[model samples]
Target: PTPAAPHREQAAWWAVVGWLGLLLQVLLRVIRGAPSSLAKLLRSLGLRHPLLSAAPAVAFVQLPSKAPADDLPPLSPPPGRLTVVLDLDETLVCAYESSSLPATVRTQAVEAGLHCFDMEGISSDKDAKGRQRVNHVTVFERPGLHEFLQKTSEFADLILFTAGLEGLSCRTFILLSIKSPVSN
Candidate 1:
């Protein structure tokens, strides 16, 4: 019986294909400047080989930029809560000063029924949210940050002054059970 040669050539070709695929994907990310399905797909493949893992060393995908939306529920802060203009980032949770909550925040907001911004940060300018103006922000809240939220909601209006994506922010706030009473 003829000896069967190991599938070395086939394996080598597959590796090459994988590498090219990874390279093209990297280019696409550079052009788009954000994470894409391909990256996640590759990660899910569960390949542990160094060759597969090191195919693309550079991460070109840019994290999606969070921005406010047009349909935000009209805000109605507490009538006499003392508009404190509290910060939601590191000032409270003490992390990136841009991420939201430590899961603790969610709990506190839920318990207190306190409203909070998911992605809060200073816009590039006051009019950044305008159609012609770009909404810009520089901070975010932390995860499990109910403890942090408890401190702020205790005494302030807690308006989110950020350029983050409104939907994302609202979703987080809602999940936290943060609700505002409609008041005059």
Candidate 2:
């Protein structure tokens, strides 16, 4: 009777191990090949499976080289006006904080069509003390800016680009429009 009891206990343990092995095998097979729906779900969430990482890298198309200048036909002038891109900061106008403006600049301001005005409600910058500082900006236009813009506009479409903040750029545009007849 004792020998029979030992054999039964060993058999029960083997049965439990067999069932566990079968369950693990089924789980592994499911993971190895995910369902189409699961793959779509992963794609929607911008995720890639490990198997995709093992695939070859994508090939890129090669663009044709540009033709040499000598090989191209003689070019005629465009029927429409040409386009001109102008830089605003130093080319058209120079702006500086009121407190930092030089004495020499102040003397030439009148001749250069300098416009001094206070910009309010613009608290985008901070000072050395970490407090918001909205100081007055003084703009000095180039000596022949109006004449240059006028001449360029007659033969080209003018586009202005500025490195200044939006508020400053808008203010400069307004000032230029108000002062220059060519801006109209």
lDDT of each: 0.48, 0.71
In order, how many clashes per candidate?
33, 0
Enumerate residue pairs that collide in model 2.
none
Per-residue alpha-carbon lDDT of model 1 for 1-184, expressed as tens digits?
Answer: 3344457767888999999999977776553454456545666887443433435767697865764677468889767766555443344322223233366755665577543443433433446456433332222334435564566667654554423345434443454434332111
Worst 10 residues of 2 by lDDT: 114-123
- Which candidate should be chosen as best, given lDDT against the real structure? 2
* Top of the candidates by TM-score: 2
Q: What TM-score goes with each of the models? A: 0.24, 0.47
What's the CA RMSD for each of the models?
26.1, 16.4
User: RMSD of model 2, in Å?
Assistant: 16.4
